[model samples]
Target: MSNSLELPSYLEKSAAVSERFKKLHRRPVKLKVEDLSKKFETPKGELVALNQINLEIHRREFITVIGPSGCGKTTLIRILAGLDFPTSGKVKLEGKKMEGPGAERGMVFQDYTLFPWLSVKKNVMFGLEIKGLGSQKAEAEAMEWLEIVGLAKFAEAYPGQLSGGMKQRVAIARSLANRPEILFLDEPFGALDAQTRASMQAYLLKIWQNVDVTVLFVTHDLDEAVYLSDRILVLRANPGEIDELIEVPVPRPRDPGQFLTPEFLATKKRLEELIRPPELAQNEEIPMIRLTEVGDEVE
Candidate 1:
């Protein structure tokens, strides 16, 4: 027979008080961003991707930027990663101006961007090698990160031998090997099947919990955004600007199962409405020709 046991009332209350005190003492982090803007001048004309945008992304925070396909969500992230330059305004790290891409910032592009010829380990070490790190040290760090992303067993496998999801995992491990202060994910799960995408999201959350880096993820999937972020930034198309900033109140060490909750669904619905296109109202007639396409307004 098993003895039934329960915590004494005083001990339980003490534990609860301790948890509350810890929460109260914790300070919120602040990210400083100011009047961030960007534009692209092609042969057709000058296209404004972002216009006078200002945002603050907290440290160790997870932020998802979502909007219509043509919105400047990608452009904003590119600038943040230092992959592209803003037309005007500024972006900074701890209030210092960002000069260019460095080890402090790492990016995972839409495409897996892995080298087919190289084995997983080699691909993950590509950056370190270019930065002049010794082979032995680079290999050790690369292998550790590969294991973190659950890809260590495939170290000798080439990109062509792995599935899309596995390849993306390699990409993530590679990006994180640099130990960047900020991780920029540009639709990293876009190419995977639904099942694989969900799996990757879970894997990502696990990795995130162990790392203290801030994550700026761009995605069109509202469900994914709600599941992964501390806050969501909704952007609007046509001279892209942040339309709404939604703070996810859900507690973390979040499980993928949380998506089934009413709270999560409600947040997703609200974000969907906020990002819905204003030009096409509920009963509006469809236009045969999308004139804006000719102007190259969409990316």
Candidate 2:
């Protein structure tokens, strides 16, 4: 395989389509997250996971939700994907209240979520087949998405036969096959090795730049958050809340070379500080903090 996979022609943006997308990318938020909060009633008392989280995501925007544990990163993505409901506040998708899981949105979790019994193509076709899209059309859509992810050759393989990175690519293809308005990713590359993780990060950015969907990504990796997001939504733990929203001023069509550029490095350093703990931020003697201890969600 090539160091960089080739993108199919169908994935390319035509002159007219590109022009139209530029217009649609403007204001008139696609998702309105207003006063969002989630609390779970535990035996001890009300355990607040999120509080007063507000954000507006525009069409074709790549926004990443990140913070320490207990910061409600998972909860926020779940609410936006319609897998969970906010206790107080509302999430509007294109001006409509998001009630529950719908075809308009899709989610790719840390776990591949592939059926052990199904092949790659079958797994991607599951949703469309249920939606009443005939087998032929569903297969066609699945093939296109598989190609988009550089997994066209593995469409006949089962999950067990593929590597961790390949499995994640299949999961991504499955989600994109549905043509969702927004794709919610919860640490999709968290399980891979360092090398594979870096490769997948680049793959994800390639797909995102070509596709027209809005993205709400959740991650604990500071570098991943900066590399893939148009804006980073920083959350605070102890009842998760929005602390700040920082933009990635790097020019688009990003490549691995940009990772070393001054602008990219500056953005990454800024994000690290934004999420730094009060106790650690003041300690100049401490060299670094363990990832496991950082931002642990309130138990």
Candidate 3:
């Protein structure tokens, strides 16, 4: 036998993935966070929501941030979006310091924030028009985005007239029509049903592939994070800090079928290990009260 030892299949695959992402790494950094920190004043005392967070998002990269509740994932994204501020450190976008909310960044939230009174086309054109584009130009651009999102037919419809998924498509179109350098989505599909959520994920990937925008998605679903992210930012709770920035080994041009593949499973397993609470990681079981009697079997 040869003297060389065999590496595990996942490890072997990781080598190929590293090669694939080399181009991605070479791309210019679109957003940079250095020693970013945030604190909140609780009744008890100062609670550090995020501590010394550092990150870099490459141009046109899709990054997902996931963690258990209280991990400050939302806080971190909010700061980057300029919707909130950090107590310390700095956020730079395209080599310029971010002071407050600007057109360079676009944000989508779990809630459908469409203006109910505005038609779908107008909703998309809202930003363009605000930026002083002529009515004809803004409407034309809005229709183009609606077409890209497969919602052109519904351009005349109102938010209340559309399905949950359709509304989100409009929201996405509105954000993208502005052509922001980076898009921040905080659980944009959390309210959708499982089927719709999966559909939205596919749509998002297709959009990301074609668009020239960078994405930073915040989600609580492991499957979602694994399926959508080029890299997953795993955070730990209690003075929320970075646990790991996982480069997903799953190959690109991804499909739903890849979820069961070794690479996907391996990455997901590692994420679980990192995000699992210490008690659970230690296999410590919680005591439960016996509400049902010994013979309470219903089946």
Q: Residue-pair clashes per candidate, as listed?
A: 0, 5, 0
For model 2, what is the error of residue 7's alpha carbon versus the real structure, in angstroms, after optimal superposition? 36
Write candidate 1's Cα lDDT for 1-299 as tens digits: 14523312211223443564345335253345689877888798988789888887777878899998888998998888888888888888877888677877889988999988999999999889878999999999999999899889999999998999999999999888877878999999998899999999999999998987789999999889989987788888878888887766555768977776655766776776677654444587665677554766553
Cα lDDT of model 2 overall? Answer: 0.84
Best by TM-score: 3
Estimate, for each residue in 159-226, the C-alpha lDDT of model 3 and write its tens digit. 99999999999999999999999999999999999999999999999999899899999999999998
Candidate 1 has an lDDT of 0.82
> Which stretches of model 1 miss by more than 4 angstroms?
1-31, 42-46, 278-299
lDDT of 2 by residue, 114-171 (tens): 9879999999999889889999999999999999999899899999999999999998
How high is each candidate's TM-score?
A: 0.82, 0.84, 0.91
Number of clashing residue pairs, candidate 2 = 5
Question: Which segments of model 3 are wrong by more than 4 Å?
Answer: 1-16, 278-299
> After aligning candidate 2 to the native by TM-score, how far in Å is the CA of 238 from where it should be?
0.5
**Model 2 CA lDDT for position 34:** 93
| Model 1, position 85: C-alpha lDDT score | 88
Output the better candidate (1/2) by lDDT. 2
